[model samples]
Target: MINTFKKDDAQALKGIAIIMMIFHHCFSSTELYEKYTISFFPFKENIIVNIAVICKICVALFAFISGYGLIISYEKKKATASRWALSRYIKTFSGFWIIYILLAFVNIIFRSRFLKVYFGHGIWIGIASVFLDFAGFAKLFGTDTLLVTWWYMSAAVVYILLVPLLYKELKDKTWIILIFSMFFLRVILSHTDAGSFTGSNSIYAFIPVFISGSIFATTLFFSGGY
Candidate 1:
């Protein structure tokens, strides 16, 4: 029997992940309840908070989908790694830069305190950080920027660039790659400070979840079934 994730299957998974993300952002923190009342199940705040916390798996879901989709695309396209990576980056950056630039321009026009407060030190330092933010390297460089969620930007770029190389090297050995990714993630989490959400945004931290997706793609496409 053939088992595979069809296009709609992937899209449905993504929709579920998005809904989970919304729940996580809405109720994961008890502080949110302090600011806004919960009309539904108002007395079950603890249950809601716990459920929301578990919903954090949305990040892993997204990474897995990205890996699966990219690998499937690569398998179909047979494009060179550099070309594929460049195309993916261009697609990602096009949308990213539009929002990044719009926000920056708005902040500048309004003299919003975000830039001054986050991008610190002298004027030149602040300017350099802004450029880094444009490239999604500000968080990696430890230079604070406006958006905490933008850490995913750098993480996404890293995944796109790495996926082609990973597919090339491990296409035939998907299980090995999956095992290695898990081992690497454990080592990083156990040995370093990259366990927290902020610290976990490092480029290599979420490779396990991504590679799990790749493994699924390999099973479905390259190996021709499970």
Candidate 2:
């Protein structure tokens, strides 16, 4: 009883997610989006909002895909955790740091007040602030004005760091525990002031969805779908 999953199907789903994300961004702004809200389009606002909501799922899809891909790779390669971490860190951070350096240069040339406004300290403090922003701690501290969208990188890194621990300790029950813990944390946080802290972009919000992908891959393998 060999169960087969099509790579093409997965790729197609990713393509759909990408399209949804693009549509979400396109409809996010008023000036450019007004063209869709004109006379002929009766339920334009509703449709746009629905699209925006649906597009939020794309983030989960991305995290799932990442987890699935990494788990599958780990299964195939049987790589050591340290090796994997080093490789992943180099692969992930190299491009980001390169871009960050370029942006820093641009900021310096333009004599941008961004650092002073955000950090409000001397050059050493400004450098520390930049590092914090790059590591995604600035967002937690409410100073993530620089590269605000890069919070995903920090969350991904945290997940990557957790992978070795999860793989070692919860090799069998990863899915169940991850799903349960995520919901439990969500419920707990919702009752407290931390509820506002666990928005869609945060690491805590995405961990369950990401680990679900690993579970899916594991199930597929056991079910002879690999």
Candidate 3:
């Protein structure tokens, strides 16, 4: 018998993750988040805070889904790693590069007057910064300057590149290692200055989650359970 995977549930999860992300962002700016002091009769302020915290899990969910989906695709297509990575790179960065180019032109034409305010740099610097970010060197050195969210894309790219090397060796025990390593890293980082900058926005911070998802995909496929 041939085993085929149905993606309806994955699609539903993606939709839910997107909604949660939007809610998380919206609530982040509200007084409930600011004060962390809002409460009802039976619930405490920590409930509200916890809800906001849970909502932020959408970022991890997205990364997990990306890793899961890519593994599934790779299995189904039986594509070479280089070809797969190249295709993924183009698909991911083509649109991003277009937008980046447009933004660069706008910044240059405006003499870097607008983006400079937020990025604290001129057009030339902005272009260079994005290149550094895309290469994943900026985040490694704690010098990222593109945007807070761009970390996701950078991390995803790094994960994709590393997948070819790590998947076969680590796929079976991903969950165990991911959980332990991430927890240990969290504990270590919590007491360090670099922790403040890493947050949930760096490749190192999300690699475990991504690998977990990839392992899940591999398991589901090999077990014919998906």
Candidate 4:
């Protein structure tokens, strides 16, 4: 048969990991784990979860690349680390906010008649969220931003503070620092008890991904960010 698949190790690993992930998700745990000893059931002893978690570990592969990429990006472009970091922050946040605002504007302008008639409830709720984000008083008002992804802006701000630390004397120890930072943050954030809807987990979920990403970065074994 003609070659139909990517031959790269990294590519192969990613595909296999994803298949393993899907396999664990699709099959009942007892059937897969009791027999194949592989599935993702979300417990330490669960063979399926183990298999799935292994595949989920791909992010570590990108940790090193992120460190290296950031350094290269700052240096080659002749931009100060501060400027580079700020630019990235603005780009990420403003991009998301802009989209939210634009959509909300259209929705509101149309909401009285056509928008409500045409668009569904979820979309209208989204417009409301955007209006809340712009207000900047959402928390006090017991509201939230128009889009859930806006929370990432807050997270990105945290990264901005950490990056210069990464850019300075701490650069070479990127992997180690990333691990520790993630662990500490995971511990602290876990206490907040955020919900599943946010995809922002407590320590139980996040530390694993960060550690996995850090491992992949330092080892140069895989290439994924999160």
| Weakest 10 consecutive residues of candidate 3 by summed lDDT | 193-202
Candidate 4 per-residue lDDT, tens place, 1-226, comes to 2222222543555566557546544442454446564433455455544554454333333222333344334434457777877787666466666775677777668655324432345787656744556533343244454444244344334444455554453337556666677667666666666322123312223333434433443343533222
Winner on TM-score (3 vs 4) = 3
Kindly list the per-residue Cα lDDT of model 2 for residues 107-206, writing each as its tens digit: 7679775665456767777667777776556655555446666777777777677677656534666567766877887787576554543235565566
| Residue 17 C-alpha lDDT in model 3 | 90
In order, candidate lDDTs are: 0.75, 0.66, 0.64, 0.46
Ranking by lDDT: 1, 2, 3, 4
| Winning candidate number (TM-score) | 1
Better of 3 and 4 by lDDT: 3
lDDT at 43, model 3: 66
The residue pairs that clash in candidate 2, if any, are none
lDDT of 4: 0.46
Better of 2 and 3 by TM-score: 2
Candidate 3 accuracy as lDDT: 0.64
lDDT of 1: 0.75
lDDT per residue as tens, model 1, 180-212:
767777777766665653235555566777877
Off by over 4 Å in 1: 1-3, 117-119, 196-202, 221-226
Error of 4 at 107 (Å): 2.4
Residue 200 miss distance in model 1 (angstroms):
4.4
* Cα deviation of 71, candidate 1, in Å: 1.2
- Model 2 regions lying over 4 Å from their true place: 1-12, 29-43, 77-79, 101-119, 135-145, 173-175, 192-199, 221-226
